[model samples]
Target: MDVEYFDYDNYTADIDSNLTTEGTLNLYSASSSSTYALVAVNIIICVLGLAGNSLVIWICGWKMKTTVITIWYISLAISNFLFCALLPFEVVYMITSHWPFGEGLCKLASSALFLNMHSSVFLLVLISTDRCIMVLFPVWSHNHRKVGKAFGAVILMWVLSAFLTVPSLMYRKTTVHGSVIQCHTDYGVRHKAVVLTRFICGFLIPILMIVFCCSVLAIKLRSLTHKSTKPYKIMAALILSFFACWVPYHTFVLLEIDFKKHNLEVIKTGLKVGATLAAANSFLSPVLYVFIGNDFKKTLRRSLSSRIEDALAEDIRTALR
Candidate 1:
């Protein structure tokens, strides 16, 4: 969802306005209104995601009592906030099709994006693991799910994310394309390996692990004959929504690596749509948490922080009982 999309070779576009004497394509187009529309959508997403996630951080980090679950949610919200913060840079670059931020900023932005994504997904995995353990081994979970442990795990997740994001940081660069300066990654000789590695590590492994943990939790609940299947249902929905958002992005990434020449229009459109969907996932998390954790209609009256505090209190009471 980050500059990974820009890991392709020298890109050429059909929009004709920014052509130089040497005939290179600019990032934006004066003629292509669709690009502007996509940029508009990104801007909206940026504002909403930033505002919503800030509230989440305030509530989860400051208002709520520390718990394993709250720790995980805090980590998730932080990732969402950081990711949304970088969208404005992307918006400007997309609008003018120019990289005015210089090489250092470009690398930093790209690295931050990848870091957020990797951290976000891994945190989900940790949440799922914690939920599974809580359900299956309640006593052990109660004894062992300490806030310090969760904090340590979150720190490890960030370390892993930062380490994995090295490729983007190393490869992202600014180059002059025709008359316009463009920022993108040059995957060069390691393109296929990098693409496959990212797909497997960034998407496949986490999802598979999530699905496994959720499935095990579901079966355990079923065997116990629990009447309220709402938690399981919400977990399923969360995983499904994740797959829906990311599958297209990863699929298009793989296709773009190989079929970049075959379907120019489709590839370009898919890239735009995929990035939007992926970025939109940030704001969607807080919504999903609110809906799944509380009575959606009832929570509407109170502010988001109040609603989150109420829902988290409910969760703690449930866990204790």
Candidate 2:
């Protein structure tokens, strides 16, 4: 919506007295009211994701026998966990509806954003390819698909992802909209250009390749109809889960541009809701690990549940004192 929505004319009815020509125009718009909800949700997510991801790292790195595939997924999960740790700032931004964090963070946040943008798809693609190789050439996989090779592949994937997302870092900025300062990337009309580029380069292209690779693997691996093939099902779920989470987010981003031109009440409400649902995606990734862990996590979690509950109870009791 550019900065017009916060201008004297549109907002004069609600906040005429707050206006200041010389002072910073506080950009707190109606949208900034998601503060309390954002704060609570963010804290919960960060705590859970940090604890869960730490558990995953401990399990994969120390407890389990080292496999190349385990090493790859562990890295991906750790990255996701770290990125979610930064959710507190986003929560703060949503709650206070102010960018009090400053311009440097605003730019830095864009770089952090690149991690999420590339990590999910690339990891999924890697998993699919890894499976395909395992299925199609079972004997060849043992000799070749070593931990070192998986590590090399992950490095290459990240380099390509980082190269594509460098543009986002370049475009992001903290802009004053009113009493609420917000961080976003603005390429003006060139936004559409970036969207198309991302669709082709970031999303559409990778997704198609993943599907194709999986289909080939599934067909070739029909002979080895054993329990080991279940990982592909989990991988399939991950790919679709990624799509389910992100499509709405990207759709809302486009809808926001439209919302600027016409602030219809219905559209605004839809955008607001969509924005919340999109935020939920950030928290959903760690949950996906449970679905993949068929027997191991369930048994371990059940055994530990009581002791963990006792510890939690003790912490609450101490806090109350």
Candidate 3:
């Protein structure tokens, strides 16, 4: 038995099919449109995410004193910045499917993408865990959860994420196929294992940890004497936003394994849509988690200009002195 297939070199599974000319043309057209849309959305997300996360890093790192919460936010912002900065390369690659950036750069880009993604998720897990601990055992958390510990946790997460992304560096390549050099991972015999590992460790396990922590936080908040539950509500919103944005991505990631048995156009469209949603998560995080409070927004607005002016005055005073 012979099978004919169309190859989508980046992130899609092998398609085994014998299709009519019209069907193939439709698939190609659909894929092209989806790729264009995905790239466009990624560009938008890149701009907004970079700006948003940059502000977050500045605010949390410079304007405020270091704390456990600020450390977590800064870590998240740094990862998001790296992810957003790398998005332009993806846009270029998607537009031309021709890898002009050499194989080493291709591997680096792929590895960084996964590294940032996993790091972001793990940071979210850390934040959730910290909040849960604070709610459940305020005295213990107050005494034990220091900024230094948060920094250590962030460093550990980055090391773990790098280790997880080693597969990307090993498997990724820019292969010339029919005059088009495509950048993609060629996992070979490890394809299924890689996919399963990513789904389990990257998505499922972290999300489970987040959910458990959030649940405990919620229960503790409900049992408290204070009727105000604003903190819990904010945390819930953050978790819900993350799940909404990433569930599609992880779902399509698993489904791509069986994409040969599915409709090509549907699978491709779903994958693009999922990627856009997941990318948008980086842009949304700063607003949802850090800037949602009215007091925070007002303080930022009021302080930015005054802070700049004050710094300039201080510089002049030092010069005069």
Estimated TM-score per prediction? Answer: 0.88, 0.74, 0.81
- Rank the models by lDDT, top first: 1, 3, 2
Cα miss at 228, model 1 (Å)? Answer: 3.4
* lDDT (tens digit, per residue) of candidate 1 on 1-321: 122532234333332443444333333454566777877778888888898789878888788778877788778889989988877887777677778889998888666656766887898799788888988898998888899999999999999888888888888888876687778776666767777887888878998899889889878877775445544444555567667877777877778666535575676567667777887787877677567755668778677767656656666666555
What are the lDDT scores of the predictions, listed in order?
0.72, 0.58, 0.66
Ordered list by TM-score, greatest first: 1, 3, 2
lDDT of 3 by residue, 1-321 (tens): 000011233333333353322122222223465666666677888898898788777766676666666677678889889888877776777666566888997877656656766888898898788777766776887678777787789899999999888888887766665776656666656766787887789878999999888778767767868545444444566567778987887776677666666776676666667767877877876666444444665547664434423332332233222
Candidate 3: worst 10 consecutive residues by lDDT?
Answer: 1-10
What is candidate 2's lDDT per residue for 199-222, written digit by digit as tens? 567677788889999889767767
- Backbone clash pairs for candidate 3 read none
Worst 10 residues of 1 by lDDT: 1-10
For residue 265, give model 2's deviation from the true position in Å: 5.3
